[model samples]
Target: MAARPGYRVAVPRTQPEQQAPPVQRLRVRYAKRGRLRFTSHRDFSRAFERAIFRARLPMAYSSGFNPHPRISYAGAAPTGSASEAEYLEIGLAQVLDPAEVHRMLDESLPDGLDVLEVVESPGGSLADLLQASRWRITLPGAGDLNGLVEAFLAAETVTVERMTKKGLREFDARAAVLSLEAQTSGDVTVLDVVIEHVVPAVRPDDVLTALASVGEFPTGIVPLLTRVAQGPLERATGTVRDPLTPAS
Candidate 1:
């Protein structure tokens, strides 16, 4: 009898079983900052695929005509902003020594990108493991951020009108902001904002709205906004660095 479509005939076992155990999976954390941070998430994914090929890492691909390599990113950074800490995960075809894979990937990444660390991911996948992210936004000229930050903190609720695919939606920006702190860097003022993404997603737009409530936004494009770090800020023992630091 002929086999059904999309079905394969089972063959009798002829080979001996392997004596050794299979290799373990590895999860790597990579940081993309500076000019590279401005690249869109889709574009960055393509860039990393090419970089993986160049690095000769054993990346696994999906089983399809136009197969895509299995990879996952923790969160997306806004375009035009710099970031110190970003994350992505690449699953290997076979289990590899974490250190070796980390070394290979670091060498393959372009400037402004770095392999921060590599280890066995806590969960089955990176997406399952990620919980939250942290961001440090800098506004130009220290333009009355003191009043804005104070007002924002003192408010019971701050509502902002945001555009959604379903038209427009208004949300309490304060609810989205898990934490916020104010500081100054020479002339510019910085707001270290951390939002919980384990549930709802937060973006620079939310911050823009909150800032606008208490201060004036630049007439044109605003000053630099950079993502400082990502992932469970309190967890994960890895080498951490401030994104604003100059490349050594």
Candidate 2:
């Protein structure tokens, strides 16, 4: 092939990639509720990365052939359950006000999945700050399970089997539970529980299994579970503190 007379062939040019250093790490408290709660952790991560890019935030990325956004997530709530408290930290190339970042990201994300709070990390890891979690389970059309709960709590160890990637394993669900109480409202019975963050991470279903192991749990009743809080446990109060809140 030959170039036409009085014409020049154009060559393609590649743009240089520029890397920026992270100036700030923002700790964020978010929520997974409603239909969005069904979103898997991997799905949420991908959506968040897309949101960060759509919002045009100067996010920091790791160094590698396949660099990923510098985002670190604390223990995430299980899928198919709603959560009021969830935590993650993101590194940014430019320093920005936490409140502004919160508002921008909140608007950028979809409904249901919300950014509740954002704070400037005071030089600590988010994973280490989480010690316990508060959960609420609502069983509709189910009668009170007070006696069943009492029996389960009285037992020294309530073992339950769960299928993990490794294989089926049994663990003591009683030791991880800090407190458990049943409350009734109309036709729905709600169970409020505070569980310590431990190995295997006993979920609400595990507690239900323990309850069933002792006594009869109403069959065909699917309960609604929600994680109300997650953070450092206050031994005196037997409750978790907000990670974003500074100690008094």
Candidate 3:
């Protein structure tokens, strides 16, 4: 091989690869409630890494010039919405009690973002185990939405459009909805829905769009959506089981 005149070849640098697996791994379920629900995913991730450091956790890091802690997150609820079953997994360089980890991290994180449960991973991927999500959406002053929900469910397919980073796209929102029901929570009317995991994930807002298309949804009304649970779906019951709970 010969070098071209006035041209220099650049060799790509390779960083050392991580050699050992973490001594301990833990899966955690947490909640984003109240004002903290407005926190974006990036903001939460940065805060979490800081919490790990502040808690003096022996977190496992990747091997490189810029090593990042080995923390894996499952599908996160959209911003501006609360969640009770957000999930993440962390790798640790040392073994520790799962309960103790939960207690310490819960104390370290800011209020409104609480750690609900922690379990030692039994050697499996958390992402693969999660199959669906259940949500509760409250619409204040919107009146009864039972007719709209019934119409949306009766249809074979209810398409909705939303502006995404890749431009406006259309998808069938009805297909992902496993169950939809209207219930009263004190003074507010709530829509309890269970949605199966699918590509281009359907959000609570998309479901609302479908409802608006089918029936009357009062204008000037804002919806409060909260992800109630996310984990393995029970097809018979159309509900998601807690990942932290052992299968019966």
- Which window of ten consecutive residues has the lowest lDDT sum in model 2? 13-22
> TM-score for every candidate vs. truth?
0.75, 0.91, 0.92
Error of 1 at 232 (Å): 3.1
Tell me which residue pairs clash in candidate 1: none
Candidate 3 residue-wise lDDT, 47-114, digit = tens: 89888988999998877677788999998889999999999999999999999999999999999889
Candidate 2's C-alpha lDDT?
0.91
Regions more than 4 Å wrong, model 1 = 1-23, 64-66, 164-167, 198-200, 215-221, 233-248
Candidate 3 stretches with Cα past 4 Å from truth are 1-19, 185-187
Is 2 or 3 the stronger prediction by lDDT? 2
Ranking by lDDT: 2, 3, 1
Q: Which ten residues in a row are the worst by lDDT in model 1? A: 238-247
- What are the lDDT scores of the predictions, listed in order? 0.66, 0.91, 0.90
Of the candidates shown, which would achieve the greatest lDDT relative to the real structure?
A: 2
Measured by TM-score, how close is model 2 to the native structure?
0.91
Report RMSD (Å) for each prediction in the order shown. Answer: 7.1, 6.1, 2.8
**Sequence-dependent TM-score of model 1:** 0.75
